[model samples]
Target: MAEEGQVIACHDLRVWHGQIRKGYESNKLIVVYLTAPWCVPCKFMAPVVDELAKKFTNVMFLKVDVDVKQLKYVPIDFGVDCGVESMPTFVFLKNDVVLDKLVGADKVKLEQLTERHATIVVYFTASWYGPCKFMAPVVDELAKKFTNVVFVKVDVDELKSKAVDFGVDSMPTFIFLKGGDVVVKLVGADDKVKLERLTETHATL
Candidate 1:
């Protein structure tokens, strides 16, 4: 809990599986840290996962305690199949599939896997527009809010061709792109709630 970024600890297996299902629908990468309250390596690795949560904003950071009450629900598909006998087992999942897994608290390989993962969010903007100026900080906060979405800024003046390609005629247009395609587009930044909800929608991959 001392860590920063959007890290959620679901002690309940049912709820955690729901979050995993959501990740599947969005096609975002799910990084699960299997830990226990008494495991020494799990304690040491907490800070590493926390830092990665901040570093890879395009990946969802989920912490699951193996010693939790819902042991029956925990080992069904992921844990049992992956042979998670050791503490601090790190699992990387994509498209409801287990892409890779690591045993023990090795942060090096985890970083490598994240660098080759999914999901990218790009923000298109122009430097001069008053609305864009007002929305800059708001969008940055949104980027921080969603760990699975990458928020990118594109100055229309600097990259006019890219702007034209995205059909961005206005000053401030928010485009949510995934798999190299536009999934959602919002024309204005007047409403912060709408901006946040829109980002939350596609933050998963």
Candidate 2:
């Protein structure tokens, strides 16, 4: 487990998997800091990453020392070959899917990317539900349109307990969250216009 507003160092493969799983299940963004002990640029960017972690409470920061023999196979489980040719690479992920990657130690770009991806929309739905299926494509389109906002699809059946936490009682529930707080919530399969309006409203906050 990681403390609030702190980076979680994954020295072991199991810990790495656990952290990513937890983040995916909770619909939170996972930022992986790929670094090695001897990398000078990585050393310089360490404090900046820590500061960003402190600022963005909702983002999960995982530090992986690539030199560690245990984690030599970094991101192999993500299904995508993350060819990290340089140190201090920042990889953004949601639901085990790689969203974006940044190479080198640029603090400004890192902070901007973090802020951009901070806005999240947690879409609660079930595969068997009709309304959920209907809204799936709409949500997918919105996700593509709003490149800055992260849209996470959570199946109620697979994660009933999580749905209960968010008080999701109906199919096709859209919960918009900025940082970690819920800013807006919509129920039912609303038309694309209404959903997009709410998404745009909260995403800019």
Candidate 3:
């Protein structure tokens, strides 16, 4: 068993399949750290990833030693099409979807990516709406400022059903979701402070 905030190493094929499947099925964000023992860059980023695992307790960090002969076919089966071709490739996944990928030992990008996908904030907006246009920059700024929260901008015109499902009548509506459930809903473009405050609140939770 893995200690709190530590990366769970995938040395066994069955154990690896279980971890990936469970994490995806539950809508939890997962970071697959693909590495090999002889790779110097992987060595450099191992500690960095470990620290991130500790920082983002909500995110699952899984380490895969590519050199393990028994785990040779794991990457191909991991849904990272074409398998992992680079050392220290970080694949960010949620609900079996590849949200993002990073190659090499770029510590800053690694942390930023991990934090960005840890939590979600769905921003519902319409392109034709003036208020939505006004709030676009504000939302972008908030996303940049709050690295730990993901900002999903959905256009009402494009996804009318989604907007209706969220009960969004306004041009801009911010829905804070935890584990696919709505925790907070803000309907307006006038209050940037409230938006940022709420983002900070739900993100840290």
Better of 1 and 3 by TM-score: 3
RMSD of each candidate?
Answer: 7.0, 13.1, 11.6
> What TM value does model 2 have?
0.57
Please tell me which model should have the higher lDDT, number 2 or number 3. Answer: 2
lDDT of 3 by residue, 1-205 (tens): 8864789999988878888887765456889998988888888998998998787755788999877888877666654433344787889887777888898889999987876667878899888889888999998888667654667789888899998898888878988877557889999888989998998887555
Clashing pairs in 1: 26-205, 27-205, 28-205, 57-147, 123-152
Tens-digit lDDT string for candidate 1 (69-160)? 67545644565442344777877888777888788777887777665554555577878788888999998887666655666678888898
Which lDDT tens digits does candidate 2 get at residues 1-205? 6785899999999998898888876567779998888888899999999998887766789999887889988855433343444777889887767877888989999998886668978899999998888999899888766654667789988999989999999888998876467878899985768999987776544
Cα-based lDDT for every prediction: 0.73, 0.81, 0.80
Model 1 stretches astray by more than 4 angstroms: 1-4, 79-85, 120-205
* Candidate with the larger lDDT of 1 and 2: 2
Of candidates 3 and 1, the better by lDDT: 3
For residue 170, give model 3's deviation from the true position in Å.
Answer: 23
